[model samples]
Target: MAGYPQWHTASEQGPRARNADAVSAYAAAGAPGITFALADGVGDDPGAGRAAQTAAAAAARTPVADGPVTAILNAQQALRKLGGTGDAVLVVAMPFTGGYRIAWVGDARAYGWDGSMIRKLTEDHTMAEYFRTRRQPYSPRMEHVVTTSVRTTTAPEIGTTEVVGGGLLLTSDGVHKVLPPATIDGILADPSRAAATLVSTAIAMGGHDNATALFVEPPEVDVAAIVTEPFPTAA
Candidate 1:
């Protein structure tokens, strides 16, 4: 692979009772692969944050060959094994050829910011998304209920896309739910500060839950080195 994976991971408690969100990133040693994961514990359930942390750790520690979906499955199963009090949404990302692959459940999401555009990679497993797809009237209350998640479940939505010059982001609803796409698109100014900026923005926008973001800056090839230089004329 010509590119490397660089990551900046961050999280915040927001203005909520507890930080129910977790994020993780790992780069394969001597390999062009990287793995990233984020989870948001269902606030209604006690010990939700613990489940989210467990899922994040499992997903991030997954072997490269096991793949993204497998990692998520591990996370889901791991949480189930813990016998925790709350369920959670799990989102995992990994390098895939020229682009990246994302596997997710529930409302937490993955996004690609390639400088000029901000692309949403995963569809929320919430009623809002369900209604949007069917072109039905969506009630605001429906947003509170997630149709799918890592509640001892195996199914997850998977997406793939080449990265934008900027990078990739995995976010919990605490951040995505509040910040408009334009605001996120505008903040691509610095990927290094993106995680903190996103968390801060979500708080400023009205922090309702624990916010989290994991950023993956794709490796770049030196264009100057790739371009051929003219041969110097013999003196």
Candidate 2:
């Protein structure tokens, strides 16, 4: 099974009472390999959830052999099928024998944690990021400011990276906002128990939207140290 361990959790609270995020993945130990995808909808948009669902499902349905570009295109096509312009941002992770491939668009993010430190893997397409780079104040309100998303005329900016040996984490804005990155990194370092606690922590810390976290421990992992038993299917 490559000794990889993964955990996912989501919660809705504080602001957007309705969770507009969706996640889907197909992972196997042997032949086909591991593939994971997550999408988060713009909170203000009523149809964002549908767009996310459409995109995530599309990405997950594509052939496991497809590369990042092809997988993303397939997801875009799926959004089109739902009459969605792709107003949702998506993050995808596919684990192979050597490592994993990561691709993303919009604001949903991917984070990586080595044994000691955590690194952000994806850039956000939000205005706050622009402000941060320009040395300007980023109002908390700017969280709602999205520069790009899945839309008919707009092509999302895509970035791809390879994760060779590290813990990869993916999340919607809800999870990141409520939890500090260092805290998130610690959880990824020891994801088993922390994965479930994170969900509750977000909700407790005023998760004003749908909170989601996907933790992936790639090949060569010490599974015995993480997953002790099967994740509760109902959760």
Candidate 3:
């Protein structure tokens, strides 16, 4: 690999939501490359925490030859067998030969940063997106609901994209839903505390759900404080 990625992460439970979200990043001796997994539990039970924890650990330890889909599918099965009854949004990223393999279920997402532009690589399984794709009117109430999740029989979509030369970001919906892409891009421009900024900003903005953010680009973070700039007043 010409360029190896450096990684950083930030995850926090939303005090208001009874957060069951979990996140893990690891590199094992025999694994092809490092692995990153993020899971947001959807229910209010002990199983929710178990579901997220199981998925994150299983996904990070998947064999390099098993492939991303198999890894996640296996994770889901493991969760069920272990009596994890809660549903969750799961996203995994692992280094491949030249790029990275990404797979996700529900609304958890993976985004690529090709130095200049940030590209979303996953389509959310939500009703709002469904109506938007068809150019139909839909209520905002449907926006936060996911049509599919890690516990569903549906398969996660897997994609291979370059990350060695640029950057890769994975986030739970809580963070992305609260922070706009433009705002994210500004924070990412300075890799120093990128993940922390995302999580902190989301919570500051009243994100009611657990928030998590991970970045696969590495550097010595600057100790400078990120000042809050004023936004344009509404018309």
Estimate TM-scores for all models.
0.84, 0.80, 0.84
Better TM-score candidate (2, 3): 3
Clashes of each: 1, 5, 0
Task: Write the residue-wise lDDT of candidate 3 on 130-174 in tens digits.
Answer: 898999998986788888777774563443333443678899888
Strongest candidate by lDDT:
1
Better by lDDT, candidate 3 or 1: 1
Candidate 2: tens digits of C-alpha lDDT, residues 1-235: 3344555545453466466787786543232455678888765466887788777777765655677656678877777777744367788876554566788777788887786676888888678887988999999777667776654313346677877676777788878877987777666655665546666678788776777777765446543232222221211
CA lDDT, every model vs. true structure? 0.73, 0.67, 0.72
TM-score of model number 2: 0.80
CA deviation > 4 Å runs, candidate 1: 1-4, 28-32, 44-46, 156-166, 221-235
Q: Could you tell me which residue pairs clash in candidate 1? A: 114-164
Clashes of 3: 0
Regions of candidate 2 where Cα sits further than 4 Å from its true position: 1-6, 13-15, 27-31, 44-46, 84-86, 136-138, 152-156, 221-235
Residue 194 lDDT (model 3): 89
For all predictions, the C-alpha RMSD in Å is 9.0, 4.8, 9.4
